[model samples]
Target: MAFRLARNRALIAPAKSALGAIPRTALFYSTSSKPASSGQPQASEAETHFGFQTVKESLKAGKVAEVFSSVASSYDVMNDAMSFGIHRLWKDHFVRSLNPGRKSGGSPMAILDVAGGTGDIAFRMLDHADKINGDRETTVICADINADMLKEGEKRAQQQGYISTNRISFRVENAETLDSIPDNSVDLYTISFGIRNVTRIPMALKAAHRVLKPGGVFACLEFSKVSPAPLDAIYQQYSFSIIPLMGQLIAGDRDSYQYLVESIKKFPTQQEFAVMIKEAGFMNVGKGYEELTFGVASIWKGVKPLDSK
Candidate 1:
């Protein structure tokens, strides 16, 4: 099945040239076998499109890792410049909604912040947990496929005094196959600004469901479809044109940032994503939208059923 998908992708490539040149990395998956490893696990067969190119279901993480590694040193600066610091607020809102309770109550909140480059979400979550729980232990694991990003995250965490003797840890792992995380362990699972890069979003969603405990909360912060037509038009213009230019100027990588914007537009809408969440064995899935001018970002929440055993 996976081989057929790869062949089909090759056949359709000429038709989708409108989408842009096929990434060289896309050709890495042309054969049924895995690509030469960067020491990561083998990829699965359930592949999805990364822009116009069809990559292996499993190789997407390695590609995403390369992108982050190239950009990691300048990632935070680029993020602030590109979003005008709005990304922080989006993350803040996501943490507040998690409602880390007082620690004296019981077991510390266990959170897996997937694709959480540079430990942004994990840092904020730990801060919230400490404030609310009063020295209660909150475990936040910052997981990403990019070693460079994980290293940067660790550096930032250390510089900011966010890492304690035992509060936060970093791992290089892929979201689509979170086999490293034990089932029914985490109280909350989060992926911010990262899912759009995933080639198999549904598989990632299913993995989230698998790792989370029953009653665990799943939250995501991602770029979403905008509202109000006038603002939408302006937002699209900025995303497609301005954002990549900013990336080039700030990060010295125009094409990567261009790919980033295209990937966001290719992502599912807030409504469609909610349905995917439900289909992944989550319940009561809901989404909250934040509109900045015509551009929109969203936080999606869902609960893993206690009865899902």
Candidate 2:
């Protein structure tokens, strides 16, 4: 009986040794076939569009930042060349739509222009309010995520005499989360030709809703689909071929231009995007969006409800 018990102990020792040899981490992940990778566990990287490429969601923002940084100096020039200055007319209409400060309670209306690179929309808002309403009190905060783009905007603002009056200010702020902006403080929120580039469109929409005061307005002007077959064919060709060529010639950055062109195609249609705005708790439901220039671009507006929770 002693000899038999000793023999069983010898066998158990080898089994215990083998169990000790297994990695501690392996024991935790024993149910899975593969081990958990080293370093920060890969983030649950849900994919988002970066033009035509299906990139890891984590990498899209960096790529977009690179594109904007590279093209910041040349962006305005390319816009003029690609659209033949027709973009100006669109922007003029956009500013006119808001009639900003014209009807706001006789106080300095606070305008938050998100992703407003180079202050194009903000400048328009300030200029119109100054000229039309003689509203020296109105102020604009031109917010952009890209520093290089914002720097360029500040330089332009200096040249245009907007800096001295203090009517316009610049902040480097992300669209997905306007971290520094307080709740229900902004009087008007405008994003023009910029919404499609956002990594999370819904988050940006929510941010817009969050920042606006009760009865404040939210407006977005963005590229849209051309529904007519013949027009779409022409538009597609121009965007895919001509726009990239212009980028190469003007900005010396063909890849960035190509990405921007492709991004325009991936954006939602006017009506679909309007529904998204409503989902973010904006009022006017289905009645706030308008298509322009044969659906090449669109304007969407929503007012925060006065009695919102």
What are the per-model C-alpha RMSD values against the true structure? 13.4, 23.4
Q: Write the per-residue lDDT of candidate 2 for residues 84-106, one digit (tens) a residue.
A: 78788788888876777644335
Alpha-carbon lDDT of model 2: 0.75
Best by lDDT: 2
lDDT minimum window of 10 residues, candidate 2: 8-17
In candidate 2, how many Å is residue 132 off?
0.8
TM-score of each: 0.81, 0.85
Which stretches of model 2 miss by more than 4 angstroms? 1-43, 102-105
**Model 1: worst 10 consecutive residues (lDDT sum):** 8-17
Off by over 4 Å in 1: 1-47, 56-59, 101-104, 285-295
TM-score of candidate 1 relative to the true fold: 0.81
How many residue pairs of model 2 clash at the backbone? 0
| Cα lDDT tens digits for candidate 1, 63-150 | 6667778889999998898777777866776677666534443555677888888888888887887786574465677877677778
